[model samples]
Target: MPQAQQLDPDTFAVRHRIVLVTAWLQVPFLVAVALLTTGLGQAELGTIGAVAVVALGATVTQSIRARAVLASVALFAASAVLIYLSGGTIEAHLHIFAMLPFVALYQDWRPLVASVGFVVVHHVGVSVLDPEGAFNHHAAQHKPLLWALIHAGAVLVTVVGLLALWKVLEDASRATVAALEQVEAERRRRLEDAERFGAELAREAARLVDVSGRVGEVAGVVRETQEASSQRVGELSRRAVDASRAGEETRERVGSGVATMGDLEQRSGEVESLIVLISEIAERTKLLALNATIEASRAGEAGRGFAVVADEVRNLAAQSADAVDRIRETLVAIRQGTTTTAEVLDQVEAAVDGIQTVQAEVVAVAGEEAAAGEVLAAQVHELTTLAGSLSGAAGTMSELAASGR
Candidate 1:
């Protein structure tokens, strides 16, 4: 078989169905010819039965090409039988030409050629065998050759026209199949590209999630450090305030001590003046006792007893003067000690004041540090929250990409 003759299964099936339908259609024409010739006799029944049998056999056949070939032969045979049975009716001859176009359904020129050949051979054979039965009329019997030529010419024209049309349809079918194949290839390429893009997107999303998680971890650590530092600063601030209070108290106590030392120094000065007056009185008494003793000696022997009494008084006065001198030395030592103590108290008071000033500055600095630490802690907390949100967003994106893939 030629390439055109060997059709795909679907094409064969379609041609097979056309052949069956055409075969059945021929039955009416065959019946009409039989009725015209024999008037409802056995010949009409025989012709219809033969064509029906052929169509049924072809339909049941396993091979599509065989079915087409059988159907073509059956149709051509029916055309010939109908013409012969009608006593070679001219109208019955048209059936042969009509079959040419129907056979073209096979999309193969071979079936058409076979149909044409069968018609030519049948006409010649039947006309020679029984001229009266093949032509029916006297005129057709005399010029059988002329009639055969005219019928052949008509059939040839029909064959040429149908085959040309078949060629055009076959070309179109092949082109359509090619176009569909190209479209399918493009669709497959697009699907593969989408899959590749989805994979890359999923990887990027996962990377973003990882980066966000790391940032969140760092933010958490920073926030924790800020909180600890803030707590320590607050504690230090409180301690500074307490230290400032203690320094002030110490300064006041030192001031009080210095005032007490000043009072002690004034009392020591008054005691020193009284000791000087007592020393003068003792000296004057001693001089008076000595003069009394000298007057008693000048009064002679009667005044001897009085002179002894005066000497005893002068001795008592001398002892009193010596005691006064010792008392005056003790007072001078006490005055010197009080002055030194007062100077030391003044130095202590000044040191306490300086300490209080330094403590006040420390308290101010510690309070400022605590306030700054609190602000830093708040900022760190905000950053941590932002990082957590970013991490969550990246996670959601990753999940969506995964689901898309």
Candidate 2:
């Protein structure tokens, strides 16, 4: 299809056709006017017919713009000449109105003025050439020169009026054409702007879509990470509980060892006391033997044999007491050793209990940390997904915008 601007050539061609058709239409009017006028016989009709045919031929052979002026001039000259030869008549003068519209279309006022002048001159020429017909002698000469002049003036004014009306119509047409062109230009500009904006929107949409996709991808990763972290945390929590239980068992074992050591220390102290009692009994026996020996000595020789027996008994008692004293010392040393061992075991047990407590605390902390990590991972995943979704939406928008462009 031809664009609106490109239609101008076609429009001009159509207008030319219309002008040709209008000019052709004037031929019949010319013939009729000739028939109804004075001094216009078959000869005048034939002459006008030939001229009209030639004008139509010229219009068909050439372009409208080229032939319209020629036709108007030729027609005007012929009419004037015929009127001069016929000595003018009302029918001849009135027929010139038909060509006025074509003259206006030609956009050349000269042709219209010439045609009008031709008619006016015909009036004056008729009065000079044939006074009877020019002054309306057929009406009993009742119309005077003033009346004839007034009649000519009326024709002149009518022609002028036609020219004015034609000019106004042409100006209106031009204005309408200009306004249409402006409207078309504005419409084209708006279309371009709309396309540009649509492309921009599509790009934005595409960007959003890309972002959303990335977010979705990130979300997926985060989800996976979160699940893994949760599993790990749960495992760590169980492990930590196991560690705490192990620590408690170790503490209990240490406690049991400490109790056993305390019992051993108590048994050692009892043995030390038994050794001290044996030593005291041996010392009293020795003192009693010594007193008996002294009494026997005062009785002289009879007591000699008794003193030997007492001395032997005294030596045995002294040996027995020394043995008890050494045993007591050994028992005291054993009790001290047992007490030291119990104190060392107690310290070890306390240290083991402390290590177990620390291990339990570490396990508890690990569990908490693992749980926290899982939560953080979940949140990160969600955020990444959201960002990806936003990007995706942007990308889609961009595509849509691009398509619009």
Candidate 3:
């Protein structure tokens, strides 16, 4: 979660190391300043220089910039004060040169100026105590003037160079701030555009919802109409089938009657022939009776019994004749019935043929109806598949919309 501005302890330590390295490099410079201006004993100079080096080492290790600067300045100021209070010699003024390099070690101008002031004060104090040995001692100290000029020039150049570096660093910091601000502004603009797009998507989704509702209503209405039409067609077909069946039954009954009439007509012809044969048998019986009467008269006393037999034969012949007359009357009725049946049979046969034709037509109509139904079913199945495909497409769109959201 750390951003670009976040500084870790290691990074901070590394920056401090840079400052420490710069401070360490100035140790030689401090020794040079002491050797160049001071003619003190080697032991004292070496002791003071060793102490200065120890102070620089402590300052570099401290890691606190302000503390490091102040400590460095204090060490050099103490050395100058010590040298000045010990003797009224120009050699003690050499410690003043340590201030310039020490100032260069710090980033802040306050610490640098403070350290420079300390060095200046040390120089003033030395001049007051030993005016003849000071760099401005009657303006005739050639070696001190030369050393002063060199130190002053070096100080001026260090201050100017540090100030210039500070200016460049300040400019770069300002540019970094400006660029960060611009990036934040662009990010805000993009967020606003995303919000606008979300609002538009919501409106479009609402519109699609309304359209789906209307389409569902329309589909329901169409389904109802289709069902009603199918029911009506079914009813019409059933009625046609019932009428056809009735006609077929009527025709079958009529044909059966025609066959029965034909049989009755043939039976009537047989009855007529039997009636004529019975009449011939009656005539033969009458003749046999007459012959028996004549034979009885010739037999005298025996003829009486024969005469009785003759009378019985005549009675039997009369009964047979009555029976034949009744049969003849029954045959006449049968003949009349046959004639009527024949006429009805002809009508029945015509009706049967018409019924059969109607049955054929009904079968054809049923076949056509079935074929039409099959076609309609096929169309309905295709539409159902299409609807399923459309539903799948809608589902995909919904998933896409959800993902986008």
- The C-alpha lDDT values of all candidates are 0.74, 0.66, 0.61
**Each candidate's TM vs. the true structure?**
0.64, 0.58, 0.43
Return the top candidate by lDDT. 1
Lowest summed lDDT window (length 10), candidate 1: 1-10
Candidate 3 runs further than 4 Å off: 1-260, 283-303, 339-351
TM-score of 2: 0.58
Candidate 3 residue 295 Cα shift, in angstroms, is 8.4
Q: Model 1's lDDT to the true fold?
A: 0.74
User: Which candidate wins on TM-score?
Assistant: 1
User: In what order do the candidates fall by lDDT, top score first?
Assistant: 1, 2, 3
Q: How much does candidate 1 score in TM-score?
A: 0.64
- What CA RMSD would you report for each candidate? 6.5, 8.5, 10.1
Which model, 2 or 3, shows the larger lDDT?
A: 2
lDDT of 1 by residue, 57-172 (tens): 77788876667777897898888778767778787787777677678778766666677888888777776776676786787688777667767788888876776777677677
Tens digits of per-residue lDDT for model 2, 1-405: 111122245665665556566556656655665666644677666767666775666476555445655566556545554443444555544545555565555555545555566656655665655555554345524443555577567767776687677667666777898999999999888778879888778766766776676666777786777678777767877876787687678778767876776776777667767766767777777887798799779978999988988888789889988888788777778777777877887787777778777777777787787778767776876787678667666766666666666
- Cα lDDT for residue 245, candidate 3: 74
